[model samples]
Target: MTSQTFGVQDLTLTSVSGSNVDSMTQLHDSYDLAGLTLPNRVVMAPMTRVRSNPEGLATASTATYYAQRASAGLIVSEGVHPHVEGQSNPLTPGLATDEQAASWVQVTDAVHNHGGRIFAQLMHGGRVGHPDNTGGLQPVGPSAVAAPGRGFTPKGPQDFPTPRALSGDEVVEHAASYGEAAARGIGAGFDGVELHGANGYLIAQFLSSNANLRTDSYGGSIENRVRFAVEATAGAVEKVGGHRVGIRLSPDSGIWGVEETESRELYLALLEQLSPLGLAYVHLEATTDDDTLLALRKAWDGTLIMNPARPGGPTPAGPEDARRWLDNGADLISFGRAFIANPDLVERLRDGLPLAEADPATFYAGGDRGYIDYPTYRA
Candidate 1:
């Protein structure tokens, strides 16, 4: 393995060794995503790889990694912070600066060269971050609450800090940041942008009743709680055009001390507001039941990208899972960890080839060992 240090993080590259099976024609079926036609319906889900430099810029390795997995119907890049304070972990990429956006050009160009449509997932960590990770800037959220778990900082894992509550004006400003980042991503040659409103991030923090104890117009009622998400999505849509914007939401996920007691009402109201936006798609990390998923599908008339992961399972979605979600009205299916270890995931799944298990140890260790060294299937 070869290693290099970028800023305060060390990245390593190592090789990894997979077999052949029959083609899954259904999974290989093409689908129309906005104006872009995806060659297949297997999407590479946005995952946090932490492979960027200290200044929060994507490196050449980052470009190569995504380019290797360009076989997917669509690729959603890792969670990219829209601002410095929005970064939740060390070494994660960002779109907050011109240099950052320029750095991402390599990634977009690489993926595009391989005939892959890529979307930049704009993520704001909010209360999920620590000052240690954000260069001494305190994380900001809908309320002054700290996430339950520790955050991975440059020094080491540290306890989550109580974030400052953003004022109504500041909240609007933060929402606008998504739009700015979306434009930056587009400028960098990305096909589109996906707003990260899921997984207990800033938008999720505002949506969750437990995390958001605010009494302002951005909280309290379901409508109020969903205001930030709606505004953020709207802003992104306005900036990049609705056809180039998407939003990802994880309802009923209790991660990071976020408890959405009113998940149903909150998401429904949010969807109602977003349905008319004519956005590209809505990616759902489905933590709810079949009924709720069905309801969500009906509520949002546009395209739905569903990622069905078990409560605590380590495995990513397989062909069976894809079939199930597609039958249930999902326009596309996304695989996370599976893509981490299987660059040829689309071919592997399509041909029923055995998947290479991802090395859990190297997931966020900042390296190419488990990032890009996974080989394609051979007979």
Candidate 2:
């Protein structure tokens, strides 16, 4: 089933009018992904809290943290490194171990108990890590180059180390690792899995010309560069079902010195190939939602999910912004910071109520004081 003929069966899309703020109340109010029905369209984007056990497993706090956000129609869990060497921070958890995989079971159970669907986001922060963080294992990427900035190591902030460019065989190994992680995510009872290909991580490193200097099948031309990501995603879908998968892409992102002269070609070809996978959706993060991406949305032929840029830095837009995307043909809008501060974001948006401000200080700290302590509107 190519994206060209990708069927949209009874997809409940809400109507939106410029003058009517309530028009968005029905957008994707009733949509099914792989047999699971969503109550609404708002999705909680994956965020990194860097809070995990020393052995790199999710703790009880993690489960409680996610359960609080179960009100969202869908939840994309925090980034989980698929491989040990792929670990970005010691505090960041992984699904590589039996315990690590088992720990996430509580999280999925919590979400499902509250009628929420959650997807574990599999991320591999390639050159964006250091040996100090990975038990002396060398960070790997498409090229043996260092990113242009520092990363938070266990000791403290240090320069981003030059990564070992992955051999063709290693690329396959990592892709397989993604598949294994997806399988583990399924075992943990997640509704689905998402490939974290954005934010200059492993996949982004391969996509960017500045980071990927390889001249082989995984580099040079846009097609070759995107091949790694497509293949990785293919492996993930193969392990877990296609309907149980999603991919996040950050085209033209310069984070960590990632740059692409022909991002349009790279992503277009990537999406064109991925369209047939029957994946849940394509998650895109662009500075300003551009028409080129919107054109890709048409080409994608599946549900298109967008992460809008927040004016005040990482804040999720209000109902008006979500409505704007719906009016422009977006299938779903993902909220980051707003979801963090407001657990009942859907009700707040629906009733036109004021939102609570997120305290930036405790965004990543480990404690229930800020994690699940945000109060809902009493009025």
Where in model 2 is the C-alpha error above 4 Å? 1-28, 310-315
For model 2, residues 1-379, the per-residue Cα lDDT tens digits are 0011111122233433344434444544766765768788888889888788878888888887788788788899989998888998768888877789998998899888987889999999999999998889989988899988799888888998889989989998987888899999999998888998988899888888888999888889888888888898999999988999999987776777888767777788899889889999888775434766676777788877877663236544555556667666677888887777878777666555567767777876766766788877753
For model 2, name the residue pairs that clash: 14-27
Q: TM-score for candidate 1, please give it.
A: 0.92
Error of 2 at 77 (Å): 0.3
Per-model C-alpha lDDT, please?
Answer: 0.86, 0.80
RMSD of 1: 8.0
TM-score of each: 0.92, 0.91
Local accuracy of candidate 1 as per-residue lDDT tens digits, 1-379: 2211121011121211010112122567899898899999999999898889999999989999999999899999999999878998888999998899999999999999998989999999999998888778999999988899788988888999899999989999999999999999999999999999998999999999988999989888998999899999999998989999999998988878899977888899999999889999999987887788788998999999999785347656666667666666688999888888778888777656667777778988987777888777663
For model 1, what is the alpha-carbon lDDT of residue 192?
98
